[model samples]
Target: MFDPVSTPDVQALVYASFAQLRHCRYLLLRIQDPAAARRWLRQDAVMGLLKARGQLGRETAQDEALAVAFTHTGLLRLGLQEDADFPFPSAFREGMNQPDRARALADANVETWRWGDLPGEQRQDVHLLLAHFRRTPFDEQGPLSAPALQAGGLELVQSVPTCPAFIERNEDTKESRLFEPFGFRDGLTQPVLHSTAERSRRLQQRREIDREMADDSVVADGEFVLGLPNEYGDLSYAPDDARWPSAGASANAPPHFGSHGSYLVVRHIRQHVDRFEAFDAAHPPPREGAPSLTEQMVGRRKDGAPLVQQPMPPADLDGFRFRVNDAEGFQCPLGSHIRRANPRDTLGSDVRSGVANAKLHRLIRRGRVYAGECQQADHGACGHADGRRGCGKGLFFIALNADLDRQFEFVQQRWIAHPQFADLDNESDPLLGGRGEAAFSVQSPTAGTRTTGLPAFTELVGGGYFFLPGLAALRFLAETEPAPGPPAQ
Candidate 1:
């Protein structure tokens, strides 16, 4: 048990980590009046503590305060945003207006484009729509306070429920498994922040300023909070600067342009564990003492080391000295899910740099393992007789950073989904790769392993991009109602 009184920093970090957990729910509110919405947010029943300023930004401060308050009140944290009033393309709006029978057909097109199947223009439009409503700010320095929630006029229209917390059991029952989407023990290797000492220690492990820069670049504290400067010395922004600028950048630059909140992308991906297990079972490899198909696919032993680098030992425990670069593929295969997700040490010369080019695109991952009996029993067989039908599994993949393209998208498209990774024979991420309907594979020569023809086993059921506005932005959003008509014209 943690005693916050004894260790406030640790307690705060822990609280922050819990807040980081993506289990927080979300809701859509359509307020007939902005004042009423403000009033609704300010209610004591809904309001929590106010976050300090200079945290992220005013917008993010509001978000953080709300999250903290909700968590304290035993209510799931919720992110709220307003709808964009734009002229939806004729074809797009028409699709939204389709009859029930035709809706599915139209939705298929939308989903395809959303998943990046259609042409550039169509995909761009879909991205715009999703991002417009979804993206949030990350002003780290802003206070996480809730003076606004008390002035309510908002009405809840829709909400997504939060996932239940897992209760650990002492028995060796199959129900005790705490695996990730790709089928390996997860939630164990997390960095623990029990106190300020631990956080300071972790910070110490970071690269020096000179080591982190591309060339003679000075690292700043703000860079740590926001992001590293680009070649132009400007703080990196997301989704291409030409595209999503800081709100109102076109008209006027804010006093703190780079100091604005970061961008966060959260995706609810559902993994098909049954299909993955079946694929592994059917495609068993032929080698002595070699990894099982499951181990090979995951690139790690149940203990969390690379299967090739470290032979599974009896005492090998989770969260123990799990180095990313134990060997090319000896301890942890180059393309393991976590390895791909975060190539910590294996970044090579690139690792010398500080957070800037280091791909230190760190975001607190707060997700839950939603495992239960198979919903579609007829579609597949059970992986284990424990009757634990593992499905509906995937990450609440969230990326937070000052810039989107430099941090989040770079990790997703370049590292995780990159087809040509160093010292590995793979075409895309084993767990979350594969274009459209095509299958993907990754081969590790260290273990003489080849995981091939893994079909796409997940889909984006429902997701939206949200902008966590700064406190000022929140006020701006609340104050400025949509204009009535085309101005003076």
Candidate 2:
């Protein structure tokens, strides 16, 4: 029903999780031979890759069944040097966008962050990243370790297959469900790109199928892709000094180099499954509690239902808002995991402007729970072998946005890690690291505040910030010169 002639095909707008892809392989490649890799990327591998970038419909088209994305370091390896020559955004030049890497480097968080806490991520020679959403089933040893990877001039430095937390199979119906490590349905709520006619039509199709969703908020495609209007009707670049200097109509054009690209953030979080299970077992609250202490901590029950004490009416993903029913944290706590991650209107005591305020900070979340069980959690993904004991069970959290510092980094540092979130004193996100007050508070119209302390459960294993360029820009990168290595040592 979508005419590509009139409406621009959003093949360039969305790539990875924009569609409902379940399996994704994060291929972190170290450009062994930048020139040869570029050649392969341009001539050999990137042929149908562009044609396969369209939006996903209900029936699931074979064209976009698999999506590919390259990283900033990947471009650097392709021989782009100097901030001026590069088309990356400003946050990437200074390396200030990846909050996980920035915070993980602290000695204070070393124990909590583990392998990712060190400074290795400071400069990830991890040149290229290919996110493959396999449609067919395969039996490869690893997703990235397949023969296709070796065909190029690059070396397979690390291959991480998308892993599901646990598997649920019903022989009777021949059906199964993939759960996140912490026991909630993942990829339930995601932002829809409403800026372009192409994205809008696809989102409509998505809504027709997915009834548990409703929202007319016109999120600019620029927010996700380069050269689009951001929240403030501007490119949403940082101030002049921090901005990526531009050269065009003006001597210092507003750095539109990142115009058609998206800022991609990938975090490899290692969730302590055993510790969480033990803590939940030990901290069992009263049975009368609607969601129990643990459920309230997560703002949802294990069944992916919201922690509302009483059921009202059917709704979509954005159907529920904090300020309306749970203004005073009566239904959901003010500092709960969901609330902290998305304060809605309960932030800073303002109840009316919650949705409006929260919209600006929103980033498209495309995270898949990665564990060892996804292979046979049901079947193989895109013909790749599954059940390989790869990275431990955790979250392959990926965020896409235009403004890295304002969106991704802001959420990581300000909300998730903030000690004083909302009016609550010395309280960080309970589900995250709440070094101050670990109590999970559930405010009530009658019982004032019900609080329970929970320890930090997730560890920042590894993460990095990269620029996902437009298809045209990607081709340009392919044609660029080879990266200049360190002076002869």
1-489 in candidate 1: lDDT tens per residue? Answer: 223232111112122333332223333333334445544544444333323233322332233334321110011012222123322122222332133412322123333433221122333211111110111322213121122322343333333333322212233451333456555665543432222243444344433311221121222222222323433355443111121234466443222312233343545567776787787778675676666656754666654554543223323232222232364455455666666665654555443442234434444344444434443332133333444423435555443444444455456666666666644544656666632223333344544445456676665543333333333333333344433433211
Q: CA lDDT of 45 in candidate 1?
A: 41
Clash total of candidate 1: 67
lDDT of each: 0.38, 0.55
Best by lDDT: 2
Deviating ranges (above 4 Å) for candidate 2 = 1-21, 50-59, 63-71, 81-90, 96-101, 104-125, 139-151, 164-178, 196-218, 236-257, 308-312, 347-352, 373-392, 434-437, 445-453, 482-489
TM-scores of all models? 0.55, 0.76
Per-residue lDDT tens digits of candidate 2, residues 362-394? 777766666554335433341134332233478
